[model samples]
Target: MRRFKHLFFLLLVITLVPMTSCDDDDDDVEPSRMDLLTAGEWSGFAIFVNGADVTDFLASDEDEPIDVRTWKLKFNNDGTYTIRGDGVDPSPLQGEWEFTNNEQAIILEGDSPGDTQTVEINKLTSSELFLNMTLEDEDSGTSIDGEIRFRR
Candidate 1:
């Protein structure tokens, strides 16, 4: 009877060991959607109208440029975004945005008609974030494929 009791106790511990070990690993699990969105502020450079670098546009004060439209983009943890440029009003252009998932994508709706933009997040860090986006314009020939790198 003593030997049998010892075997049973050992088997019980073996079964419970795995369960306890799993709990330890739970702390390393992925963060929730809101947790990720609230991680930090993402600010970076952007180009609009294709073929104009952000700096060139800013330098020329919205003069015709090449390869990108110059602007600064800010994304906040509170679900707001801001865009500032020479020819545009920053306040009306700034608004709320939401991530499609915990992954790299978000939908931004502006305050004006036909002002919505969809951004695909490329990378994010403590001090910077990168994104790829195309503006909504059917008349334009070339698609606005570009990268935005923002600093905190």
Candidate 2:
């Protein structure tokens, strides 16, 4: 009976020692950039053009103001994205997105031939994303340099 008691105690310690010695730091490991970007849906928070605030207006129209508060832009892990809102063309914009420039930039290819856009990533965090893009104003034949900020 004493031998049995000691054997049981030894077995319990052996089993618990490995379990307690595990490196718990694995739980604190930070997520990668791709993991952060695709974690959830993001919406427009602000837009700037040529150093001017333009979040309330359409990129091509100064007379009309667009309420971008309802917009939803989602980046998926499968390299696809969808943008929907009051001002988005074709109701919802669907496209394929890819990370470029060593993951420092992003390129979006939309349905139309002229819908290709390359935007530099100004910032990317778990909750916020900022992109700098150079867009051409088709009506004015001028380039529009801007930053678009999004939040999750």
Candidate 3:
């Protein structure tokens, strides 16, 4: 009986030892989501309506027609972003953005009275950024493809 009791106690310790070790390892590991995004001001030029060239949306020249479809995005280090454009009515949309698990896509949550949209980050650079968005028409249930580029 004494020997059997000792064996049971030994088995219990062995089982608990691994669990405790695993807990310690988890404490030392970093969060997976935190590693996905690089905090900074990502600005660049963007095309309109999936076009291939950069238009004069941001140009200061009076001769250039005001293209309200262009947007400039500023991603801050604090996990917030501001989107300014004339395409979607009232202009300038304020929201928070984050990279998806794979770090290849971004999810944006717009503030009050704004709809949320997920954007695919196609290309990124210090001075240039490119992305695509599919806008859905609520009344017609039609989807339109759009592209945007930004230059800092």
Best by TM-score: 2
Model 1, range 25-117, lDDT digits (tens) per residue?
Answer: 657867655564456544445553354555454446444332223445666767787777444445326878888756668888887777777
Residue-wise C-alpha lDDT for candidate 3, range 1-152, written one tens digit per residue: 99999999999999998877756655795534333234344443445664645356433435433353455567765777786654544457777888874877788888865667788877665555667878565557898776666665
Worst 10 residues of 1 by lDDT: 61-70
TM-score of each: 0.53, 0.75, 0.54
Q: Rate the local accuracy (lDDT) of all candidates.
A: 0.62, 0.84, 0.63
User: For model 2, how many clashes?
Assistant: 0
Q: How close is candidate 1 to the true structure, as a TM-score?
A: 0.53
TM-score of 2: 0.75
- Residue 137's C-alpha lDDT in candidate 2? 58
Candidate 2: misplaced stretches above 4 Å? 1-23, 57-64
Clashing pairs in 2: none
* Best candidate (score: lDDT): 2
User: 1-152, model 2: which lDDT tens digit per residue?
Assistant: 99999999999999999988968877797888899889999888788877788776663465544556667889899999998886677669999999999999989999988889988999999989988987565568899788888898
Which runs in model 3 stand beyond 4 Å of their true positions?
1-44, 48-70, 138-140
- Each model's number of backbone clashes? 12, 0, 7
Q: What is the overall TM-score of model 3 with all chains considered together?
A: 0.54
